[model samples]
Target: MAATSHPINLEVDNETLAGTLLAPQQRMPGVLFVHGWGGSQARDMQRGRHIAGLGCVCLTFDMRGHEKTLQYRQSVTREQNLQDILAAYDRLIQHPATDPERIAVIGTSYGGYLAAILTALRPVRWLAMRVPALYWDEQWDTPKQQLERARLMEYRNSRVAPETNRALSACAAFSGDVLIVESEHDEHVPHATIMSYRAAFQRSHSMTHRIIDGADHSLSSERCQQAYTDILTSWVSEMVIGDRIGHLN
Candidate 1:
């Protein structure tokens, strides 16, 4: 079936967010796409369209202070970013074509970090994160700092900035299916950061991970991008659509 897409504007507390919605011909599970820092929904648009073609409603939106919302960047806060993601989730679930209880979320980099945080806050059934960058309270923290703090008497989890703490806490509690993708040749988001996130998902029921060799943080090459797309689509097929179909049959 052919897929259709349309522009959407989401209203938050005091700002408006711009995004796009891709819908398949039939009602099915919904997928929300969150782009990385400094990126707009454009980065995820193609992926959204492709995923929607596979019978899921997909949403790709620009984060605050990005693309259409560039003017608001200076005023955006970490708390606001969290709010944006929540708002997007709410909007997607409310769509007439969406299955509220069956939803998937895909985020990359900073967006990946946010997606991880969302799982604890929302009823996300499937989650995929590509090179999810770690932050402590929205501020980048060195692995050494995280490690040193853990070694100290101070509770590492509690000592983290509020946002980071919330995400970590949520990840610790979430028991859903998850996919964590790493870039083998990436220069950003070091190995320690990756492991830090891996450690938090101790309770995830099904955790799958992959490393895209020869890919940088952005998966710049055409081959790398295609590999990333394939990985995500395959996971969505198995974890989202396959599971839904299995229940019916």
Candidate 2:
């Protein structure tokens, strides 16, 4: 139940990234978790515990806004956010307990985008993306969808700060077994975004898309969270069994 904590100074830059280490009584796999907007490494505490329970080492860390990241300057660029991801990945792989080859990261929304981009840029053996925002959407048939999206953009403009936008923009280099999930009633990203991602990949066999019944954007419902955990664990199971031929779209 106890978790280890550490501070990692960026090797590429010089900033520091705060992280927490969670490990089970047994050694199995190493999972690095990246959270979404207003989320810290602790945002998905339950999921982290679950990963630990599965005998995997879990690493959770705060992004630029969550913890010690405040000490650094405010940044609003994809390059900067990718820097953070690279730093976090480097921190995890350098650990003596981590196999490097067996390590993976679970990202939700914003973090999902980062994980995708990072996988494309780095050497990731596996990836689990939860409703990732790294969409490659190109289809539009209805004008209503655009109008609705414009309204949503206005809302996002009023709420989220500019730095968050920069980070979101930076999450597009991912190319792996991207597991994209959608809550049936998600308030944030529409299904078209997922379609865009699918289109970008061109029916790539490295994607698994699922919809949690009766769930919303946050996956706050107990049933939704349970579904999320189950799907993620199953993905891990497949990875352990070396089943890489994933479903497309």
| Candidate 2: stretches off by over 4 Å | 1-14, 24-28, 68-76, 135-176, 202-205, 243-249
**Candidate 1 segments exceeding 4 Å error:** 138-164
Tens digits of per-residue lDDT, candidate 2, 1-249, equal: 344444444444565666777665543457888888556776566677766665566777776655666543234344565677788787777666666666777888767767766765667766777776542222222221233455653443243322234323333334445577777777776666555544455423476788898887788877788888898888777765453233221
Residue 247 lDDT, candidate 1, scale 0-100: 79
Cα lDDT tens digits for candidate 1, 1-249: 578888898899878898888888777899999988777787689888788878899998987878887776666665678789999999998888899888999999878878988887889888888998765543422222233333322332223432346666777787778899999876766656666677778788889989998899888899999999999989887886677677799
Question: Which residue pairs clash in candidate 2?
Answer: 116-174, 117-174, 137-196
Q: What lDDT does model 2 reach?
A: 0.63
RMSD of 2: 8.2
What lDDT does model 1 reach? 0.79
| Local accuracy by lDDT, each model | 0.79, 0.63
